[model samples]
Target: DKRIVDWTNAQNEWKRREIVLKYIASKGDEHELYALILDNRFVHHHRSVTQVRMDLNIAERTFNRMQEKALWEAARIIPANVLVEK
Candidate 1:
């Protein structure tokens, strides 16, 4: 059905890209990098943002900035779909 197809498409789009996201995160600072994958399904570790923040012992504002940077970096670096013709 439509829901199944949509879910499959969503999963497909994120799955491969998540691998690249981890690679990108690994290229940065250790704690800073955690913002990219913590509590993410692709990483297989589930924790709330506050829990992660507490684990990291960082202030909420700092965590917010880190999360924003991680997200935007992921957004900026992840490639958009392009049709390739052979």
Candidate 2:
């Protein structure tokens, strides 16, 4: 427990989102794409899937694939114990 870094305030989802951004940024070249999609979908929560696809000029299928990849990577970054299922 002492080793795990948990600076995010659980009551404030935005803090967790910031941690997610930092973790994603620490990744490789793919981080940009992952960051963009994840930021819009989860971090910012202002852009819809269609808006992202339009902004990127990618087809729905491609967007879906990228979104899936982003989610998978984000899932790996966050600790399992910290995540609560509804």
Candidate 3:
């Protein structure tokens, strides 16, 4: 059970990185991308941030910040008209 838990956690982290990559390639927002990454079942398999950076060729903090920025921009780009007036 311990191994399974560890494996699952690691896998989730890897998936998070993968999701971030996909979102970046697609020009997705940073904030939304991060939120998406943090969502359950996505974090990544790697335990150390350094390992992630080396493997993914990106600094973990940088990736996180970018994702956050992208999400913020995405929200701003949304059309207000799309929202129904109260």
lDDT by residue (tens digit), candidate 2, 1-86: 63343433544566776788778977877787788888887666768999988997879999999899888888887777655577
Stretches of model 2 off by over 4 angstroms after superposition: 1-12, 81-86
The C-alpha TM-scores of every prediction are 0.61, 0.72, 0.33
Identify the candidate with maximal TM-score. 2
TM-score of candidate 3 on Cα atoms, chains taken together: 0.33
lDDT of 1 by residue, 1-86 (tens): 99999999878766756666666756758534553444352244666777777777878888778777676565566566611224
Q: Whole-model lDDT, candidate 1?
A: 0.62
List per-candidate RMSD values in Å: 6.4, 6.1, 11.3
On a 0 to 100 scale, what is the lDDT of residue 41 in model 3?
20
* Top model number, lDDT: 2
- Global lDDT of each candidate: 0.62, 0.78, 0.49
lDDT of 3 by residue, 1-28 (tens): 9999989976765555555545544663
Question: What is candidate 1's CA lDDT for residue 54?
Answer: 78
**Ten-residue region with minimum lDDT total, candidate 2:** 2-11
Error of 3 at 59 (Å): 20
Clashes of each: 0, 0, 19
